[model samples]
Target: MKKIYNNLTFRVLTAILLGILLGHFAPSTAAQMKPLGDVFINMIKMVIAPIIFLTIVLGISNMGDLKKVGRVGGKALLYFEIITTIALVIGLVVANLIRPGDGVVTTGLATSGSAEAVSRYAQQSAEMDWMDFFMHVVPSNAVGAFAEGDILQVLVFSVLFGMGLTRMGSSGQSLIRAFDRLSKVFFNILNIVMKLAPIGAFGGMAYTIGTYGLAALLPLGKLMITVYVTMFLFIFVVLNLVLRYYKISLWQLLKYIKEELLIVLGTSSSESVLPLIMDKLEHLGCSRSVVGLVIPAGYSFNLDGTTIYLSMAVVFLAQVFQVDLTLAQELTILGILMVTSKGAAGVTGSGFIVLASTLTAVKVIPLEGLALLLGVDRFMSEARAITNTIGNTVATVWLARNENELDMKRLRQVFNKEEIDPLANYDY
Candidate 1:
């Protein structure tokens, strides 16, 4: 009983249930709980930049082979592109076949708060310039990058710092060891921040239910059900097959990271669990270089869940507005989404903004249809975050195996729960 009470998983699950009850009975008070979740996420974000920077620099400097770093990064990006494309195609096909929006009455629907939300996303999407985005990846000042908490910018700086350190030969060894110790310090900080996850989980769930209410799901129940079903199929079928080919089981991986998934489920933000996932990947026997390089990049480039949601949301909206998209037009939407989806990486409310941008580009679907989804978008985000988390986890492990960077013996022991202390190998 004491062990169960102490388990992180048990605490999170209990928080979720209590949150739902509170939201249902005392919504006005529950809505005020947003700060609880915000503070928790802020605590986690405080350590993320330093952790990523130190881990990447240490991993690269220790490897002492820039060629291998380049190869790992190249393969990781290629794999991300291929898998995310397949996810887009699957979402499109599933949406067409199910026609979740068919027969929905769109007449006289009140936009109310939703119209403002749509306008906000539309403006953000319109302002997003591809050239500007690429330029933004190269930070004007390294300190500003970390201060702003820009992952891509920090990633760029870390890689260059690591490469420069590699060229220094013996002189870099002392710095590498220092950075390695610094990484451990941040991980220790992570351990401390993670203790508040239950409160974050509770607050996140309460706020979501309180603000939206369970009744909001009733009107859009069909679309919500379809989205959940499609995501489920993508994970168990598409992602499972990818892992199987590499002799890894999706179920086992899911079981291993159950705690992180629950936190994502409660928080609806994958960023909340980013550091924990990176640490787990390393513990699972993936080399630090691969985990450092692949996970951070995957957050931006390999958004499997976001792509799937974007593609499906577009088709669902078209159907809701009684618009018929010809095969060529649908293909055009797919092409536009493939590019626009990548642009959403760092932006807030990216899913809706990406959908708005896609509809604006296609010129067939009514942008106002977006207002219809505003109510249920929060519900679907859990699925998107979870799938994105799982997809990246698989990508890191698979790439590590391909590069011969994984420790098979350690991997077996960790998954089998035979390792007495998982962090022992990392010299903790």
Candidate 2:
């Protein structure tokens, strides 16, 4: 067990060091690493829809009642909305106070052409109106949606299908049981996929280093540092306070899931850890039903990290463009983000869209600010994924405790038991 921990640590540190060195000394070679990141992302993309579909179907079918799923889902979403709004507000307040983007005007930093790019992307995105967004959710063909790998649309279909199965009552229970069996199969597949994480991590890091190089990172280093510090504060301090209030040790829980967190950091895709998180929460003693419902919903709705990024990036863009935002207008961005950021779930680059939307709402920063950050966005994205996963994970365990679905004693035992035998039996 210690060897596994040691190896994982070594892989992570090695990736970071090699990436930094290559990014600094051989940027063109580093640029070639872009495909490595693509491969890693594709590996994750390959499984996300299947995992979401299976988990939801298994969770709902097990409940044996569609209405119960609705009730639980409604409550879970309500919690997500409330927490996500709080995250947005916190981000807005921080960005306004710090003004990380202020006094920053440099053509050489990266993507100086973003001003024009923003105009072009906006015109194109504006073509995607409310009707288009709503209609896209319906999916002209379910199979096609899966083939295309659209998560929200797939989720929409899964909910309806699961509900239909529930209404079938006894007959549906048979199939639901089947789905429960299949859920285990899919989870096994997920395990196989996760084995690729180290390579994914290496690819992701190499590409980041090769493209941006370490030196380019220096220009916006303050913004990166500020965002990271803010993320750490939220995870350790804010989350720690909440966990402490519950009489749980935050570090204990984190240590229990260190492997999962490292996988997320390497992949930069929370989806990569979806199955593992479900199992971990179960091992931690959250009821399967709550873990199934809340964690997936959190992916779509409770993206605290992405919310923070959108708020801060917009403020930074305004600073770069030298546009002054009134207090009222900044508040407006916070409110819009509270809504726009909700619908687009489990979508990579969704943050950029949210940022574009916020920029449009405020009419201060141009959409081009997205293009500016596009280069280093992947680098920051790993951090965003890490923070978002931590927030949602903590929220799940904490809420499960409140819902009486968690075993507090088990949580403490799992966390506090210092003698972890790597060869120790793990239920999964």
Model 1: residues >4 Å from true position, as ranges? 107-111, 420-428
Candidate 1 lDDT over residue span 1-428, tens digit each: 99999999999999989888998899998899889888999999899899999888988987789999999999988999899999999999999999998987776443467778878888987888678788888999999999988898999999999999999999778888888888889999999999999999999999999988898887778888988888899999988898888788889899999999999988999999999999999888898999999999999999998889888889998888888889999899889888888877777888888888888889888888988888888889999999999999989988988888888777877789893564465421
Question: In model 1, where is the ten-residue run with the lowest total lDDT?
Answer: 419-428
The local lDDT score (0 to 100) that residue 201 gets in candidate 1 is: 94
Model 2, C-alpha of 423: deviation from truth (Å)? 18
Model 2: residue 244 alpha-carbon error in angstroms: 3.9
Please give each candidate's TM-score.
Answer: 0.97, 0.88
Alpha-carbon lDDT, every model: 0.88, 0.73
C-alpha lDDT of residue 246 in model 1: 78
User: For residues 1-428, what per-residue lDDT tens digits would candidate 2 score against the true structure?
Assistant: 67855576566656656766776688788767766656766766777777778777766776676676777778777777776776677777777788788777656555755567566656644553445567777778999878988777787888878777777877776777777788777777776766666767666677677766666666677788878877787788777876787788889888888877876776577776766787888777676767777787677777888887777887778877888888888878887777677644544457766667667767766666676686667778877898888888988887777666787756666777644444543231
Residue 5 in model 2: lDDT: 52
